[model samples]
Target: MELFNSALGKNITFVHPKFFIIGGLTGIPNITFYYVFLFFVYIVSVVGNTVVMAVIYLDHNLRTPKYIAVFNLAFVDLFGNTALVPKVLDIFLFGHYYIPYNDCLTFLFFCYTCLSLQSFNLVALSYDRMVAIIFPLHYQVKVTHRFMFSFIASLWVFTIIAVLISVGLLTRLSFCKSVVINSYFCDHGQIYRLACNDHFPSYVIACLYPVIIFWLPLAFILLSYLYIGYTLVKVATGEERLKALKTCTSHVILVANFFLPLVGTNIAAVASYIHPNARIINSTLTYTIPALLNPIIYALKTEEVMNAVKKLWKKKTFINTA
Candidate 1:
């Protein structure tokens, strides 16, 4: 747990531990159970995201640009869960926080790409919904399958450029002093803080990327929903109107689940910057809580997926009975 140390006449403090949670001490009751629980969680996350994507693929009715965007979002979630959860499960299993510098850098890049791309995917989904609701008659023509594919491909390109810029900047930073990362995962902000040299460029890029990418898209979602709501209120009336309203409710719920925690995480980061103790709250929100909430959101929002799962279970049950 030493923060700084010297090894063989050279300063070496890369593996020092700095912070400890109150309940994370060794010799806690049944610590093996936590790893078991984390394994189950990872399984559920991967399965849920995979099933959602599959449902969108196999169901012909679900083959629209709106659902295409959803499929991409689900794909992002798949990668996102993989990036963080397995490493976390390993940490829980081993009770060690050893991460090699090169591995750490690669892990950070992959993790950042997943999280950042997921954010972008959600924004794309929102915009897709906005266009459909705003122009129902022209929706099919405007957002052709070709257009959707092109858009998604562009996103992958842009994300790679953005991530390369961030990771490339981080690589240029001098890690002269030490290397041990404090958290269960190597978060970008936390890793940036570890650099013994100046990190001004890293700071500017981190702050600007989130603002331009996440916040602006969130604002667009809010604006799009408001317009949709106004349009719905003006036109909706009977059972058909009620059905029309239901179309967006699921998306709104998904958007809220996707966005609100992130907003909270950003706020927590600000609070931590000001108060220091608030980083725990920030870390919990960003890393721990999101892992559980994402699958739940998809399960609750996608009724078609729920129905398919139900059908799948019933079929398995019938076969077993026979």
Candidate 2:
């Protein structure tokens, strides 16, 4: 590119590959069975997230700042699963393993953008709950639709820019080594390491992405809850504390589902020698299972969402009968 040429100068002759072979999940035992299972996951994820989004959209009572984040979260979950699962099935199940370089980067962009947004969306939800619980009287003024929309928009812009910069850095890499990417998709780390030239920038991103996208959001959620707990203890009665804490059950479950497996797998990989097959499976599931479970958890655990769904169903039934 003109940008790449200008940045790296005329002396650098980059060996940009025409295509990358996705070799992850390539040789595990009975991988077809896993793909079949993922097929069903894709199905349920689509249905559940669709229902969640539809319910939020149709119900006037559910149109709060909190449900805005919930709707965004559901949308991201659906988009992420759609971006990931079908391509994965195509790559391994149907034996279409090769992806062009530009297409690969585009794939990485969609998948990672959606992935990052999931955590950011959770942060929004946590913030919503924190303000609602800790500053109930001021919540109306503090956590308005305008504020949430702005906050969530900024989060989206931030995630997109960070991911774009990382993807751009890959353009400078000269892959003199094997073109076979070790991860399931066009993984940033696997692709960059294959480059023969200086890849320190890519390496930095590989290290930093986890912290920015995962750990930071996780810490923020925990801190928000700590403040919520402190405020509840200082002001509310014991019964009141329990009632307030009950409101957070759905968010807590969502947080645990999203963060724990990712943190756990990263910790395990760092602490010991993990097999490639096992590591790949864990990482894949970490990306996937949460999307499948998020809407289900929210719908069942939050009485508001359940009631909204029932209300929408009853209205539909009434219209049909008329």
Candidate 3:
């Protein structure tokens, strides 16, 4: 855990460690290539998620409860990538590896908050889908804009409270040595691993945190989908069942896109035999790749979004021709 040594022929006792971020310590032959790749991902994530949010905001047809949830997810993705990728770029492209203590904590706070918000948003989207499929007649009556807004607001408040409690606990831990985090960005697990004091409380919180934030929401989503499936099966019309299943396809894809990398990263974290570089790589991809792909997946697979894009493009073309 001793991270520094003074070579002045004297014993050095006091050292305040500034975190050294080693971006994916994979020992790639060409680091610049990796930097360029990450830069492209950053740009795509920002632009794609921004465009998704903008389209959702401007289009009146997209102002439903489902698309409102999509808008929130896009916003979270945009905010998260903005908070994380620039610092990663600084580390890989500009060689600025030293992060101050407070800055590191701030980054970890926002990253955790955004991720937790996304999980809650997904649960909201699943509920929206369930209501739409199971009770189409009552969907409008029950899932009003006012209700959706209140639900989303409550989710934000809950996520903020949960993340603050966790981050507040994190800030109290002492980091006397071993400040080098072997990842591209400041992550909760990485930061907690470097604590020099009694981190039992933090460790307990960490173990329980994912269960509350991620798995619970995921379980709700699965149950919603299960109910939707049962409802579809009871429907006598083949076309109705197909339509219902089609509506759920994009959400299922999105859920897989977000959760697979997360599960992989968590697995790597606890597997002691895994390489540090592999763990770092998994963690980096867990956040960044999902942020980059979420919008793409929706635009390509979701019929409503694609129709919106086409309509917008046609309108632009008509205006240009006129």
For 157-263, candidate 2 gives per-residue lDDT tens digits of 99999998898888888887799998889898888989999999999999999899998999999999999999988999999999999999999999999999998
- Of 1 and 3, which scores higher on TM-score? 3
- The lDDT values for all models are 0.67, 0.92, 0.80
Note each model's CA RMSD in angstroms: 6.9, 1.4, 6.4
Those runs of model 2 whose alpha carbons end farther than 4 Å from true positions after fitting are 1-12
Best by TM-score: 2
lDDT of 1 by residue, 180-286 (tens): 55555666676777777778988989789888677877888888878877877787667755676666776777667667877776686667543333454344345
The alpha-carbon lDDT assigned to residue 93 of candidate 2 equals 95
Among all windows of 10 consecutive residues in model 3, the one with the lowest summed lDDT is 1-10
* Residues 1-322, model 3: lDDT tens digits: 1221222223534333555455454365676776677779989989999989988887799999889889999999999888887878787677777777667777878988888887888898888889988998999998999889999999999888777766666655677777777677776777778888767867888898899888999899988988888878887379889888888888898888888778777776678756777677667777788889999999999989998988888988999999
Q: What's the lDDT of the predicted structure labeled candidate 3?
A: 0.80
TM-score of each: 0.79, 0.97, 0.88
Model 3 CA deviation exceeding 4 Å by range: 1-29, 268-273
- lDDT-better candidate, 1 vs 3: 3
Instruction: Report the lDDT of model 2 for residue 109.
Output: 91
Instruction: Rank candidates by lDDT, best first.
Output: 2, 3, 1
